[model samples]
Every structure is written in C-alpha cells, then in structure tokens.
Target: MQAQKFDLVSPEFKRNPFPVFSEMRSCGSIVQAKLPLIGRVWMATTYDAAVDMLRDHERFPQQAVRNGKKNVAGIKWWMPKALKVLTNNMLLQDEPDHRRLRGLVEQAFMQHSIEEFRPRIETIVDQFLDELELKFKQSGSVDLIEHFARPFPLAIICELMGLPDEDRPMFSRWAQGITNSGSIFSFLSMIPKLWKMNGYFTQQFKKCRVNPVPGLLSSLVSAEQDGHQLSEDELLAMAFLLLFAGHETTVHSLSGSVWTLLQHADQLEALQANWSNIDLAIEELLRFLTPVQMTKPRIAAMDMEFHGQPIQQGDYIIALLAAANCDPEKFDRPEVLNLLRDPNPHLAFGSGIHVCLGLKLARAEMAIALEKLFSRFPKLHLAVPEKELQWKKMLGLRSLLKLPVKLA
Candidate 1:
C-alpha cells in the first residue's frame, strides 16, 4: 500500500471524519496513511488491527528510536531542558521504565482510589452546575467548554494535585500551549510557553518540598526524594502529565458528548429516563466520539510482516482508535449513537500496558457530570447551530474550541 497522504489538520477531515474513517477502514485494517505534520505511517483503522497493534507492544514499541531520523511533517520544537523533562513521562516510556513509573503512580492511586473520589467529584459537579446556572442567568447563554467542561476537571485535577484552584486558568493555558503542537510553526511557537510552564512547575515542586500537601504532587515529590526510579525530570514530567492528561481529553469528551447527545435527542431522552444506563451511555460516547481519537505513534521494533504488510525496524505506526471504535465489523450500527450499547469493548482508553492510567477517574467524571447536566437542564440545548462548532486539530485528540449552549 502506498503512503496515502491524509492531511489530518485539513478542515474538511476535522469537521466530520466518520465518512473518511469508514472509507479508510473499508480498504483494510492497517492502511498506509500520512498525517499532515507527522509524515508517513501505517494507520490501523479496524478494531481487531488496532487492538493487535496496541497490545503487541514488543512488536510495536511506544518509544521512538533514540537517533532515528524523525521527519517532522508538521512543526518540530527544540527539546529544551524543560521539554526533555516532560519527554521522560510514562506515556513515551517502554518496558521496565514504564513499569516503574506507572507502578509509582498506581501506588499513589491505590492510596486514594476512584471510589474515594466519587463523593468529592460529585460535590464538585453540583457546585459547577450551580455556577453554570448562575452563568446562564447572568448572560442568557454559556460556552460549555469554557463554563463547564473545561472547569469541572480542571478543578478536580487541581484538588488532586493540591494545586490552587485559582491557578487552573494558568494550567489550562500551559496545557493548551503544550498539546496544541500540531504544526511545525505552532510547535516552534510553544518553546517559551514550555519554558514558562516548567518554571512554574519547579516553583510548585519547591513549595511541595517546603510544606507538603495531601495530594498526588506531594506524594510524587516524596517518591523522587526517596530515590524510587523517579528522577527530578521524570517527577516534573509526571506532574505535568497528570495535569495535562487528566483533564484535556475529559473536558473535550464531556463537551463533545453533550453536543453529541443533544444532536441525538432520542439517545439523550433514553439516557435521562433510565439513569442505570449511564455506564452504557458513557461507553457509547467514548466509542462513538472517542475524544483521544488515536493512540500515540508506535515504532516497529524490528523487521516483521503484519497482516501481509512488511514493517521495517523503527518505522512509525499509528493506531486510529476513533476509526476502530466505529468499525462496522465490531459495532452493529457504527455511525449511530445508542445509549444502551451492550458489550462495548471500545479502545478509547487504549489497550495493553499503555492504556490510560486514569480511565476510572475519567469514567467517574463523565458519569457524574453527564447525569447532573442532563437532569438539571431537561430542556438544555445548543445555543449555536451544530454546523458552527469548531474542533481543534490536536493530532491524536478530538477537542472543541467552544460549545455554546442554552440551559432554558
């Protein structure tokens, strides 16, 4: 298969990509495709193929080769001191290193598990919804992304990290700066932002050292100090990763899910009528609109034949989770949204070792937020036309710039 160039950032594809994905999936599982800024790569577009590629970590490693010729199709940023720290995060790690870092993070969560988070998350949801009501009352409308989706998890993550709620806006700015590295020019543009973000994290780490708080950041700092395979660089990376990873996708997913349900009124009504089906609704939402659309690019470990295609060592491969989630072979009605979808084995959180570290927490936030949102505003709806909604071109994620809604 020739490397078919599919400009990922093109507005045409970004607007409504299911048709494109359907076309790609119809061709085969692992299609030779090229992203706008990421050059050529094997795109796994089917459910079985995506799962196989993701699960077979040994054959398709997560780490890019140390000295591989990384052709930046988009923008490339200089790996400054701070970014190098961020690069050492678990998302980009393989094998023992991944295990160790993930173990530490797991240990932290074990001490403060998901069940413990529900009450607090629920309380936070109520407050945010109340605030949303106030915003609607004051302004007659609200951008859900800015007013609700974004703030809900930002506040939760801040509380988890023992960071100040007041600093959430700052965190969101840094996160947007970091994750919006979609183009070469945009990637180059975020250097100063990265530096600034790292400096702020450094200050926060120092604060944690002085008077530690009962949060994940303090625990990670202590782990680093105790010499638990957690370097200062990794520590900073983990801290940033937690804040960045914890909320970015969830915010987008929540916003997108709301927008999606509103578009499909029957699904919204069905879910609202039967609260027991929320888990199914969340599953369908994750699958139908997989927010973290694709898994990070994986490099082939060595020469191998995959589904009759030759993969050379160090070649990059991308698993299209969004496409897989919508595969006709796996989903009965791949294009439609069914809140009561059963046996939903979606790969929205990915698979194998590198699956999302905070899947449970993400589910909790989605479930709580959606229930409260729908129940509170039974007559809630989109303020603007659906055609006007703008999606950010973050390579591996589906994010909306804004989602205006009226809670009347």
Candidate 2:
C-alpha cells in the first residue's frame, strides 16, 4: 500500500516534522506530496539528491513566480504597486542578473573585508557579555535570546549598513515585523513595517549618494563596473535582502547553538577544554541545530526524475535540509553531538550559487561570540530545566523562544 501524503501545515507535522521526514526518507530519498498552503511540492531528504537539486540551476530554476510572492495573502496590496520594484531582487532573479548582483555585493564579503570587521565584532560581543554580566548580578538570571542572541546580530548588521547606533532598536523591530514566520497574516502585517524600513533606507541611500561612506549600502550605491550599474529597484531589493537575511538567520543559529550546547554539557565541556576546536564545534552545532529547517521552494525548470520519481516541469520542490543533515548515510551517529567531527558537509547555509552570501560573516560572529561567551561564563548553565525550555512551534525556522542562562 502507498504511504499517506505529507502536509507541511498540518498541526501534527508543524509540531514535529522529523517523524514525517523520517517516514518519507525511509520510503525513498525523494517523496512527492501536497502541502497545506502550497499546492504541490517535492520533498528531497537524502544528501545526494539535495545537493544535486541545489547545484543544478538549469533543471531547478530559482526565478519561479513564487519567489516574489511573500506567501502573505495581502502582501500584494500592501507592497508597492509596481511589481518590478519588489521582484528585481537577487533572491528572485535568474543568472546574469543574479551573477551581476552577487558580484557587486561580493566585495563587501571578501576575506580581507571580513577580517577588518573582526575587531568591531569582538567589541560588540564584549558589550553584550558585559550587559549579561550586569543582568546576572542584578536578577541572578537572564534570557539569553533577548539580551544576547537577538541584539548581537542586529547591532552588527546595522553597523555594517552604516545605520546610526540610535537606529538599532528600530531595525530590530522592522526585522521582526518583516520576517515573522507564523501565519500568513503575520507576514502580511509586515508590509507597513517594511514600508517604514524602506523609507528609512531611502533617506540613508540619499545621504550616501551625497556623502558616501565605505559601507555595504554605500558600496552598492556606488558600484559600477564596465558601465554596468545596479538599477534603483535592485539596490532597494538588495538592501531588504541583506538586512532581513543577514541578521535573522544568524540570530536563530546563535540561539539554537547555545540551547544545544546547554543541553549537551559534555560536548560543551569538550569544546571548553580546547578552544581551538570551536570551529569544528560550530560546524557540528550548525549541522545539529539546522536553524533554517525548510529549503526555499525551487521550481523544476524541465521534466526530470528526482531519485527515479518523475517530477514535471514547473513543480515546486522543498528540500528538507534539517532531515538531510541528520541522515545517517551522510554522517555517523547523526544525532550524536561530536564537536570534533570532521568532514561535516551540512547544508545549514545551503548549497548552490544562491547559497548564503553572509555565511562568512555569520561564522565569524558565531566563533567570536562563542569564544567570548564560554570564556567569560564558563560556569554558565541553563536556569530552567531542559524540558521546560520553550521552542517556537509552527514556524519554518527552528529556534528557541527563550533561553534563560545564569552567569557565574
């Protein structure tokens, strides 16, 4: 008999998707099913198939119509009337445009550029830790998610974009308003919030146009090579993408990583023993945490067979990165948290030309933050029991709602 079809928005599936994914993976590497909100979508579980689908830009096009549609019912009405204004983004564009946009933005992410920001990042981490210490002293307990995880990434990204320090709080609100992944209404509510952000950025862009600095936004504004200049809409779209994508994922990763570490004290101790091994620990943590659980929906550009299952042209495929990362075939003792595990090929940042552009910056922030956090608060332990920790449910992103830790 055939197995039941999987539904992405079903209450049971939303509460815990791993069991459904496990059943599907057991049947085959690839599975076809209908989602609740989304009509028909292919689900890929195995590492090989996931990588194949991600790497093949020809067979799986990223420029599907669904890319621009924000999955919110009223987003169309709320956003600018000109569809071109919203759709001309790197995330929604195909090559040549994608390549051109990425090339211009790549300069800000070069190795030397990232290294230059290390000192500033370290300072930011220190400030957060200092505040955490103060709170621990005052109240004897603190929520790490609010005090540290959320603010660290927001401050860093805001500074990178050349936004003033006073504007950091507004940036945080705008980001949450735009990226909240609950109901479609939650996403729709962000339209007004994003409009505010857009207006703020427009003013900033104009300021840079007159007196530009060497920041990411300014660089993009001034970027011109061989008479190729990014269009005004493209610049706005890139700004939205960078601000939303750059900070939110890293915030989730940090929160999830800390929660995972506290749960697995032995692994945390092992990393504390040799700080040099933190890099490997970060990779393993990233693999285990899998912050971004669902892959962006990709449409099959042509008729193809995904692991022998026929997929028609223009079909939406949702690759489960979290499940693939934990596949036993890909890693030994997939559930075990081994900080020293080598050859980790996890797709936490994703796989392909459209892979995360801020990956390096994310890693740098995580590494520095972990080093400072663990070093300063070696006796740091969760204030509440593991089971009492609250995990965000019915959301695409896997993250802890609150992580209360006490600094010794």
Candidate 3:
C-alpha cells in the first residue's frame, strides 16, 4: 500500500481515533503514513506489530542515522540547538548510553520506592480534593483539570524532584505552551518557554551542587554509576524528561480516568462498592484511555521488509500505543472497558527496554487519586454535557482540555 496520510491532531480525530486506527490495522499491521512535523513514517497498529517493532531495537533504533550523520527522533537538520538538547534524553537513546543514563536514578522509581510514597501521595491527593471541595461549594462546579487534575500531579512531581512549590504554576504555563508542537509556528513559539525552563533547571542544578538539598535533583547531581556521570546538557535533558513525563502524562491519566468513570456510571458504582482492588480498575482505565498515544519516533536501522512492507534505512516508525492496547486480537471486546481485566498486558506504559520508568509511580498515583476521589465524592457528576468536553490537539498525548465537574 502507498504511504497514507491523516490528520492525527485534528479535534475530530482526537475525540475518537479507534475507528481510524481500525481502518489502518485492516490495511496491514504496520502501514506507512505521514505525520505533521515528523514526515513519512510507519505506524504499528496492532498488538503483535507494536510489540515486535518496540522490541526489535536492532531494526528500528531510537536514535537515527541520516546522510552518514546520527540524529535523535525526527529532529530536522535546521532545528534550533536548544530543541535538539531537550529531545536528546534517555528516551531517545539506544544500548549502552540508554542503560547508563537510566541506571543513575532508577532506584528512586522502583516499585518499593513508589510503594513507600503511597502515604505522601495520599496526603497530597486529599489536600487537592479538599481544595476542590471548597471551590465546588462556592461555585457549584469546578474544572477538575484546573482545580485538581493538572496541579495535583504537578505538585507531586515537583516535590519528588525537590523543586520549589512556588514554581509549580510556571511549569504548567511552559508545558501548555510547548505540549502541542504539531505545527512549525507552534513549535517556534515555544522557544521562549524552553529558554525559561532550561534556565530554571540550570539554576536548580547549581543550587544542588553548592548546598546539596533533598530530592531527585540533588541525587542526580551527585549520582555516579560505574564511573559514569551525567554531563550538564544530559542533566538538563534528563531533568526535562522526568519533570514533563512524570507529571504531564499523569495529569491526563488522572483526568481521563475520572472522565472515563463518569461516562460509565455502572463501572463507577461497582468500584465505589468495593475499593479492594482499585488497581485493577486503574489498569483497565489506562488501557481504555491510553493517554500517551504514540511512542517516540523510531528510525529504521536498515533496509528491510517488515511484515511484507518494504522499509528503507532512515525511515521513521512509531508504535500506536492506543491502537495496540485496543487490538481485538489481544483483548476480548477490546472496545469495551472492563474494570476487572485480569492479565491485562496493555502497552499503555509501553514495552521493551524503553518502557516508562515512572510506570509504578504513575499507577500508584492513579489508584490513590481514584480511591480517594470517589470515597469523598460519590455524588460527583459532570458540570457540562459530555459532548461539550474538549480534548487537547496535542500529537501523541490524549489530554482533556478541561473536565468540569459538580460536587454534590
């Protein structure tokens, strides 16, 4: 089949993309396509294809080689140097470099470490719920994204990284300005925010070196493993990745989880009746929602035929995580949301070596957020009709612009 093109970032597509993905899957497991700002690429649409491409790093590496030069992701040759630095994170590396960078701070995100973080996350979640309660009482309604969803995870991630609480609001501003880079104009407009973020992170790094405060920043500053240490540029890249990924994705996950439950009153009631295994419910939501829609652009490592499609060296490929999660071959009634889906092998956090480092923490936060939310506000309902809800037009992320809710 010829390379296909579609508006993946359009509001219409953002609202419901499964049918489009289904069409793509019917054509082939891996179909060639074109994405804005990323150029022609292959999109892995099925569970098996997605897993194979993600695991076969040798054929499609995170780092790319073009014109005898190495580049990361789909970065253009003329893009600004600052943008390149931000994209040069561990998520876009391969092999030894990826392993070395990941090892530096892996301990803090381990399952045991995240488990210990439960009480603190609970405290934070409750605090946000309390604030939401006050706002709801005063106004009779609240935008969950503003009052709770966005700030809640941002606060947790900032605190976890030892950033000042006062700076939390600015991070959101920067994130909003830069999250959707589907167009060249939008991409260029975020340079200022990028500059500010880079400057702020640099100052924090210096402070850590001089005074050595607590949190991940301090640990990363002094962290060394096997005689390997992070350089200043790498430090900036790593910090950006963690801060953005740690909170931004969770913001959507939390908000989307609430929206999903509100849509399915039956599932909501079922969960409220028994909070014993809310983790199961959260997993199902993760699969059903699939917040981060696409994997980082992977470069074809060599010329080869993948599932009968001829792929040339330097071609780009992206695994559609949302599509893969809902592949009918993998899940029974993949379109339906089952709260108690056991053995749910969803790729929401992805698979292979580049799997999300914060999966455990994210899952914990979601579970806690859901449990505390419903327990406190069982009568909660949407303030506006579902059809009027808005989803951000950001590529590769499934985020709600706002989730207005009424607390009764």
Best by TM-score: 3
Clashing pairs in 2: none
Give the runs in model 1 whose Cα sits over 4 Å from its true position.
Answer: 66-77, 224-229
Q: How does residue 312 of candidate 3 score in lDDT? A: 82
Residue pairs with clashing backbones, model 1: 37-73, 37-74, 74-184, 75-183, 75-184
Please give the TM-score that candidate 2 achieves against the real structure: 0.92
Report the Cα lDDT for candidate 3. 0.87
User: Candidate 1 lDDT, tens digit per residue, 1-408?
Assistant: 688866555556666779889888777888888776666789899999999999998888776754153522223245655476765689888887888889888877676787988999999999999999999999999998888998899999889888987888888887777777777777778778778878888998899889998888888777642366566788888987898899888998899899889889987887888999899889999998898888878888888899768888878888899999999899998888888889999999999899999999999999999999999999999888888888887777777889999999
Note the Cα lDDT for every prediction shown: 0.84, 0.78, 0.87
Sort order, TM-score high to low = 3, 1, 2
Model 2 alpha-carbon drift over 4 Å, by segment: 1-18, 65-88
All candidates' TM-scores?
0.95, 0.92, 0.96
| Runs of candidate 3 exceeding 4 Å displacement | 66-76, 108-112
- Tens-place lDDT digits, model 2, residues 1-408: 233476544445533456766777887887776554455677788888888888887777676654443432222444455433653578756687788889888865552387889999999999999998898899989999889999999999888877688988888887776555466667667667766766777788899899987578888888875688777777888888888788889988998888778778887888888899988888998888788887777777777677888887777787778888888888998868888899999998888888888888999999999989989999988998877776655445776778899887
Judged by lDDT, which candidate is best? Answer: 3
User: Superposing all C-alpha atoms, what RMSD in Å does each candidate have to the true structure?
Assistant: 2.0, 3.0, 1.6
**How does candidate 2 score on lDDT?**
0.78
